[model samples]
Target: MNTFRQHSKTRSRAVLVAGGAGFLGSTLCERLIADGERVICLDNMQTGTTGNLAALAREPRFSLVEQDVCDPVPRSLEVDAVFNLACAASPPRYQADPVHTMMTCVMGTHHLLDHCAAHGARFVQASTSEVYGDPREHPQREDYWGHVNPIGPRACYDEGKRAAETLCFDYRRGKGGGGAVDVRVARIFNTYGPRMRPDDGRIVSNLICQALADQPLTIYGTGEQTRSFCYVDDMIEGLVRLMRVDPAPDGPVNLGNPGEFTILELAEMVLDLVETTSRVAHEPLPTDDPQRRRPDVSRAETHLGWRPTTPLSAGLPPTIDWFAGLVQHRRADRRAPVAEASALHGVA
Candidate 1:
């Protein structure tokens, strides 16, 4: 059975990180392990690559599961805590396989909740700010009912996650076999980081990739659409704090940086960081994209004593460096010859 040391060796005990090979998941896994916890990473590899878990593989206490969360977890292992981050957060990736995306949230959530029930673990749901849809109010709080269009293309992820949150609460209120079954719901906002996919259409990645490649950064709709960015490290810190909250705050906290910036302003920041001559171009925004999305993190501050600490000016350097490294790796790979590489195997 999974357990924690009473005297404290590292900072955490055993942690189950679902979708641990994706950008956010992998980062969470790394943090958990660094704090002296054994980590079990569950992922299907639909969007996550092995590269995300490579660095963690050498850690004796860390392991990755190549299975989808929709399937039942094996009976042998016990987890002290479960972090359900299996759903896709980016618009393009989730909308690409809408049905599977929904399944991952609905069915995947069921599987994780069941595991939590069996193992007597703390369950943390990686909920999204998208739950608010196009916010009807500024600085969306956890109490806001949201204005999501259930029939829009974006509905698959937005509504699916909303429903998943409901299921979590349902099980918690039912007083199921899961001991305590305390749920930690984090409504995360725009978080950018090192391992993010270069082509996810997320403004940070898009701007960095375009700037590094000296290509024009495409701005969807008016560049005036606003978003608040919390760097990945800050986000992970908030999540961890929420997980370990004493008296176990039955939380649905907004874990995000409240600092707001426009798409165009973010692009300019990227341009300045990468020192690129890349120009900005306007493109039609996809369906149901939120024009203004920022989190109201007062509850997090008042309850969890957590708020983002990383400034965008400071955060962009490392992110730009990461993408720059990836671009260089790709360019070098392309020049190496066809026999040595195959697109089916994926680029670095």
Candidate 2:
């Protein structure tokens, strides 16, 4: 446990964000720190990057712990709350190592639940809309059991999250052999914003990166598959509200914007935002890809009083700018080595 040396006085709260160096986790860490909470960011750095935490480099209230959540947490560490955002969320990344992804969702969640049970800390499980796999429900509500194929290529992530949700409720029901743990589960939908990795195979990042790089925006399948998008800031607010809401909700609450759009609509929007010669290209849809996904966030609104405020029109601009900056930086970095080699060869 790294101590906050500068703040001699104890802070109001200490929150541990597992997978905190990742896209959403890093943003949550920044928000918590800005809200005057001491944050212990635990991550294995598998899909996460250290550059995401650069903003907090000099902040004493923030500490980064490089470790896998599947392992037992240190007994000495104490926190008021724990946000389990540990597993790889993207399909390409999670499917790359299916077994590890499953273990991270199951064992990693078990470890965190145990820690929270012992410490009497509130726990927030960042379950996903994927749990509602290829959902038959028009607008997926918390009660939907999901239409997941247990043995499909994407089953690793879909089933893993479902298992994690089971663990959370089990702990909450005191079935894990101890007092009931305070637990909240948020079924997050498609969220996008800054800090998203260009290589992440999500639609938002994919189209944005391709447009920035002058490559064709690949649309999977017929491009009519619909999905709801929530801004990262809005998602963070929902999570915070879920954590602090009185009397934790009995079941998972959907946290996302209900405004839905097709993949073609998103690609068109991205192309319009970015100044590039990129055109739309069709491709084979991956296995178990959901045709339509729109969260019914009535549960979130009723319980947490949270509803997404940012529209896609408002959100995509900043997201494009962030990806554009990253694309530029990467291009510059790649050229630097070549330039150095050319200089060494005296090839002006």
Candidate 3:
């Protein structure tokens, strides 16, 4: 195995972001390019879309490699660090193909770790709060063993991530004789922001899109179940800090805003921001959905000196505006064909 090469001071460091076409991945790619680093984005385009990378299309330092992480990563590509953000995150997408989701989390992670080990690059795993499914603990701490259901429908993602974390630590300990790979695990909580897909089925997107379209907002369960939201910018900052911090944190760090809000509160907030007559419509909660989820970010604060600075009030407007634009664009697209057809009939 080749020792990790230290780039010369004059050269920009190359960072590979797996799943780079996704919302968070594309955003991270932009950030790296802006920071004077060369970025290589690897994505399968399954849950990710090329539209998300529009901003970076002309950037000379940014390049995209379309491929799945479960496949063998090309050895010719050189990267100083690797950020694995490759899995289908939202329930609708992940559950659509459960087997692939499991493979992406477990086998995908294994492939990336092996690549990192060979190149001597740092690896960062974007683990989710789902690992702590239906927690009995109020605010989940890293050490708390999650209360996840192993055989349920959600198990493909939740359990797969848990197993991926295991692989990361095992590689870190050099348990199987390949040299230890520098690995960092971040348990990300609910994150929302501009690039989010309007139909992704996340609560923020669901409420914002419905409100914009004057459709009823779907509130699962009694709307009493709570979650903490972290704006995407803040979440990305936390990930960057974790990757660059001096000594790798000995354990996983919870990266999320600690401010808790009920589903009703979030819906009301969206209604207030969007000028629409949309009202709340309650729906049955999905199985294994946690009743309450707020991260215990003490570890991130103490170790990474990071805390989410954007409040919901500040974040929601931009998010709502983005969705509104998308809705309008979609409506315009729908009208275009009809308009063309009418003009053709007139010419006839």
Q: Worst ten-residue run, lDDT, model 1?
A: 339-348
Pairs in clash, predicted candidate 1: none
Return the number of clashes found in candidate 1.
0
- In candidate 1, position 245 carries an lDDT of 76
What is the clash count for each candidate, in the order shown? 0, 0, 0
lDDT by candidate, in order shown: 0.81, 0.87, 0.87
lDDT tens digits by residue: candidate 1, 290-325: 999888899888878988899999999999888888
**In model 3, which regions exceed 4 Å deviation?**
1-5, 331-348
RMSD of each: 4.7, 7.0, 6.8
Quick one: best TM-score, which candidate? 3
In candidate 2, stretches whose alpha carbon ends up further than 4 angstroms from where it belongs are 1-10, 331-348
The superposed Cα distance between candidate 3 and the true structure at residue 116, in angstroms, equals 0.3
Candidate 2 per-residue lDDT over residues 1-348, each given as its tens digit: 112222336455779999988899999999998888888888898877767777776577877777898899886778778999998999899999999999999999999999888777889999999998998888888898999999999998999999999999999988877567889999999999998888888999999999988999999999999999999999999999999887889999999999999999999999888999999999999999999999998989899989999999999999999988887666422212433322211100
